[model samples]
Target: MQHFSLHTHTIGFDGQNTVEEMVKQAKKLRWSRIGIANHFIVHPDIKKATFYAYACKGNYQNIYSENFEEALFKFFPLFQEIKRIEQITQFPIYKGMEVDFFDTTQWKGDFYRIINLLKPDYLIGSVHFVDYKGHLLNTHDMKKASFMEQKEILKIYWKNVRSAIKFKAFDFMAHLDLPAKVGLGYGKEWEKEEEETIALLAACGGKAEVNTSALRQKDEAYPSNRILKLLAKYEIPVVLSDDAHSVSQMGQYFEKGTELMKNAGIKRSIYPIMIADHIRQRIYMDWHFMRVR
Candidate 1:
């Protein structure tokens, strides 16, 4: 059936399964392709993000932030492992990373340079934090909310999303309605921001994923009906993701996720092949990159 998934995690980061285990499960599921996208964030204040999402339970500083060069060094071997597995199994495995979008002004180093160096097959850009005038608003941590108004926090979330889209560093936007992770909704006040975000994604030839992980967490698909409908209205490409962290979770609830997406007006599924082709074309044409400064 040409089943494939581009958003998956492994022990390379926060996932439960190892790369080998994930591939074996994909083969059993009869998937035509599988992409391993473990977490690879870049932020100067990442150490300050003490929440579980960013902290990795005190392992973050040692594993990720301790040595930027060494941390990046650790990732290439995993890609090589993916390549080795591909050679043995002859299964299509695309190398990808789930990148954290931090405000550039607070960035400690050149993220774009690091991305180019990693040279993954593709990237999934996500904003787990909203840098509001220096204070961080974590999407996963609602208690630390510095904003007095809920809508204000929502607005910054969309603005950070806009910044990610404008940067054009990612193949697709992951979890378009991520604030929903913490019970935040796209309120009426965010209408203009939502519309403009969709427009920017469409203009950038970008796509968003109907992340099914939300089903497990929030009982809804990401990009919700409101955003998904606009994605359809704008004719923006959409893909589905299991956001799988374990072998069992691979393609978990995807049938329902696809149905949810179809109901939301998505007509096609963007697979890894399409993402690779898009990357190739962008490189060949030397597409103008918009760096968020």
Candidate 2:
């Protein structure tokens, strides 16, 4: 087993369990370490989003913020919880955020403020929303959409993911093919964006994770075997994450995730902070390091 998960969630966010409950499960499993990476999604127009998926009941718990400055205040307690947990146990538990990527100049400015203030132990960039014909579309809505509209969204989604990778702020990117589970990214129309994203990941020396959460729903992981092979071709290092929303899901199928990495020919799992070996420069501040290990 990998013995650690740098990407998992709990009740403070949209997850089903409390941080203490999740940590207790890890202790019982005797895991080497754990990372509490709840969602940190914010968008100036999120509340006014055209998509119905974003209006779900748990948006508040999931940390969905329409204003940047207000979101920072909300993050205070989540970070504080990490310190509180540390007092009760000596086991390693890192503080992290699975941030949704947005490319607007204003958004970037606010995002930089988050890094400067929150000071999370790590960040995982993700793309859960896409712009389609001037309307914001949630990838979770693809399952019900007509194929014609879905086709256009897939292109934007994959390119959105590339933009996130090129940004180079996260230790790793989450669920490269997030739409695959919803059944939208398998066509050849978006292959160029997908290929470009993989190439950009290799060039940027960014990291990706084999998210085991998808396997529990379908036979595939987030990147899928096809993309996993592509990541191997680029020699991008990988890590396993449960994307756990509950205690039982903490390490759900990590053994399988590791095997998938091995079969895909990925050779690195970020154990000693060796990301600088070939990741090149990421334009990050001295304090905000790239620690994929």
Candidate 3:
């Protein structure tokens, strides 16, 4: 049995614990591997987006900078600290970033440039906001309004998700049915959209995270049982993520999470290990391989 957590957060973003605290806690909990995947967003338009502003702190402009350079400038110190902690702890802490996917018209060029420059151990593609006309609307806010009225917005959300998959810039997809955060289902009419998204993910050599964080909100782990069944049908790979924001949350409820994966009919998980020359090759290995590293 392998013990590792691939998705986590620290004080650099919205998390409660610092990098050092997270690593030490994981060690105490006897975790073999962990990844610090803080938010690495550079959406300049968040300042005007009501939902985003409120969610990210309305008055704080420094959090989401206008360009990648400025955002990296503020983020570099935390990145360096994570590397330092990895050396000190000698833990298998991989560098990761939970990146937001935006449409090409919005900031495609910047997105490509940032990924090329940062080159994290892995990139977790997530869609929290959907492009409405020219404005970026938070998907979670859609629940605040009637589903009938937000039908078009929801459609566009899935559409953009397909586009994100086509971009093929990420290694894994996070919270596949994220719009469901609002408790709205895709219905039979949108089943095609769901299937297409899952197929694209499989075709792109992408994996989905069985995120347990949703349980904290009293919701099922993302991708729902229906979506997970589809993933299983398509033979798509899956991984476990705590999506932890604090020390106490690391691997929280993972026992139940593994049960969810088993019920979904998923068997193996992929772990990316870097070889000489720093190239990340997705190698399916057991716990002993990870421990000896």
Question: What TM-score would each prediction reach against the true structure?
Answer: 0.85, 0.88, 0.88
What's the lDDT of the predicted structure labeled candidate 2?
A: 0.78
Count of backbone clashes for each model? 0, 1, 0
* lDDT for each residue of candidate 3 in 154-213, tens digit (9 for 90 to 100): 788788787778888777788888877777665777688899889888888667778888
Q: Clashes in model 3: which pairs?
A: none
Q: Model 3: what TM-score?
A: 0.88
Candidate 3 regions with alpha-carbon error over 4 angstroms: 56-63, 278-293
lDDT of every predicted structure (CA atoms): 0.74, 0.78, 0.74
Indicate whether candidate 1 or candidate 3 has the larger TM-score.
Answer: 3
Candidate 1 CA-lDDT value = 0.74
Q: Candidate 1's residue-wise lDDT over 111-222, tens digit each? A: 7667668778888888877766665556655535655756677777888888889888788899987887777765676667888999999999888888888888655788
Weakest lDDT window of 10 consecutive positions for candidate 3: 284-293
Ranking by lDDT: 2, 3, 1
Cα error of candidate 3 at position 201, Å: 1.3
